[model samples]
Target: MNLLHANDRRGEYPASYYTASATPLAPFPMLKGQVETDICVVGAGYTGLSAALHLAEAGFRVVVLEAHRVGFGASGRNGGQVGSGQRLEQDQLEGMVGRTRARALWDMGEEAKTLVKDLIARHAMPVTFRPGIAHACYSQGEADHAKVMAEKLARDYDYDLVDPLPEGLIGSTAFKGGDIDRGAGHIHPLNYAIGLALAAVAAGVVIHERSEVHSISEGARQVVRTGEGQVVCDHVVLAGNGYLGRLEGRVAARVMPINNFIIATEPLGDLARTVLAEPVAACDTKFVVNYWRLSDDNRLLFGGGESYGYRFPDIVKTVRKPMLEIYPQLRDVKIDHAWGGTLAITMNRLPCFLHPRPGLWSVSGYSGHGVAMATLAGKLMAQAIGGQTGGFDLMASLPQARFPGGAALRWPLLVAAMTWYSLRDRLGL
Candidate 1:
């Protein structure tokens, strides 16, 4: 069975709160017959769309192919948290890839947030970009670990964005005590995604919905085949992330698709303040993280729960499990919408950027931090194809090892490991 068909309604956005609030655009025509462009981008989420937009602005003819509508995947249905740093913390990243590369990556992480905000203003997109993301902890040990990390970030990187929560302050008990990343924030993910699509289109990029890339034939030139058409281009950008089937061996082996679910509560009114005192997004320190933020309309959009298989778990129950633990006062609240989206995760939680051969590229495996970095990755991909390869090369240079036992047994292995970590979260270990 097709994984895309397995999870979501074909060619339509999932029934999510984001979909309800977003200003819908008329669906673009499907790809048919032959086409040629300087670059052919697969997947129309932030990554591919950003590449298309940046490339178009740089005067490169770009074509974006989407299996469904634009932003129909995780881009539209995420927690909307634009977090700071890589998925791995800076200190941890330093250990993995050295201090210098980690610092450069940290600077790039900052640039990603700026790029997102700049794009929002440049497009005059109707999406609201709010600042301040508070990271929550469940235990004193967790809180202390967070404090140490915050201090490390400030001391080593010369960055003072993360502030540790006071002992008896606003978010002390509910989230234990954590830190606030003032430089990071959240957004209306679906609207922002639609805005990016519009910007890319206006910049002379052609985007085709319901245009799945069936196969790729590569040599001096590349031919990307769709059901009804083909795009012959000089370069290919495989930005499909989790939804992209087994298109390339390297990406498939390195990046494993997993499902995550989110639930939106009905408008909380004055009760919103009771749930969260401020207009900041908060994510907890769990292996399977629990992130929640207030929507524009005061609804708590809570995201948690993960599945290694193709089908989504009970969305409402799965997400609400952790959500209720944090906010037991929401027992009477009604869940307005529940949705699940697939995202790629590498073993190390860092993104997997591959250039297996000349002129062909695949950048997926964002783990859970896609809002800013994925968009930045697109621009970097454009820069790489345009011959200025410094930034893109930096990302590609990060090591991404293949899953043990390859794709066949990776599922069972990861599932067992995830179960153990989830158990630890429950046990407060």
Candidate 2:
């Protein structure tokens, strides 16, 4: 996949509302010469930068190489809803990994959310970090399921603040709400990623933007070769996610690249309150979740509607249709901007961490939950490298099955499969 070239906005920022309003930062020069470090990280997105920051804090020299600017990948251009747990349901997770291990994974998800907030506070990032994200459902049956799940979580896991919203409260003339999670929240993801990179650099990690790791040699010490330079290091980390090429065959085969898109509407001002009486981030339970939240500036940043193939539609039109379906009152609202990013997914919709070679590591395939999970995965890997093993091994031991077809045929196969599921979503299955 020509990932860098395929999604080119031509040095111009994506036509995203976030990009337009982003606070500017100084651009880093690309890697120009051969370099050496205690660890070399590929992909300067959340996972890579998080690993670099923690490893640097541990006094290990780290180098981060990116194909584009920081936040250029999915890390920068996401829907900005930071929620707990995996994309799959909690009961499904328990069924797959057993109760004890599933509970551990659930705890890890919570840790991921906390880690993001702590990182933001430490860097003083310019993002309106707020609490209370919700998952709204238009159907009463969905509401009932949400109540059961919330009760289960509270009873068994001692998790609190997961309250089910009755139809009267959330069910306006327009839409109904499902469940509220006080622990989940939203932030400007791009700002968070950029801030994290800045913090990593301040802590003595070298981050080279536009420095793609074209190839690598894995042995006792892994050498990551970029277009302009090489990073000779004791360990190599591939956190490239959907853009991870054939670097490690084992890791690459297990994860499939999936494209998801988001669009922002023109500022709704006070009218936005009419749609969502209380401003809370929300997602619907569907094969493709329709997620949206009020930006700090009050623009309704609605996200959902995915294209499984490495193909993107004219974003505004395709994404706006989905938004209108949920809130038809917004039919007259103008779409200000639209953008898309690719995320990696495994067969089980769980992330995979691997040690393909003794010193080579990769943590990716978060399905659609990469923002927080990626950060946590990076931190755990850092801990493992620093001689703390249990957490990282637990995460790594999670079952990860390869997609049915290899790269050449997987996209079409997934597109076909997801089309049927999306049909089911449309049919309210």
Query: Which candidate tops TM-score?
Result: 1
The predictions' CA RMSDs to the true structure, in order, are 1.3, 1.7
Once model 1 is optimally superposed onto the true structure by TM-score, how far is the C-alpha of residue 58 displaced, in angstroms?
1.2
**lDDT of each residue in 104-167, candidate 2, tens digit only:** 8889888999899988887887876777777777677887888899998898888987987644
Model 1 compared with the native: what TM-score? 0.98
Each model's lDDT? 0.89, 0.82
Model 1 backbone overlap count = 0
- Where does candidate 2 clash, by residue pair? none
How high is the lDDT of residue 372 in model 1?
96
Candidate 1 residues 188-238, lDDT tens each?
998988999999999999999999889999877899999999999999999
Which ranges of candidate 2 are over 4 A from the true structure? Answer: 10-12, 166-177
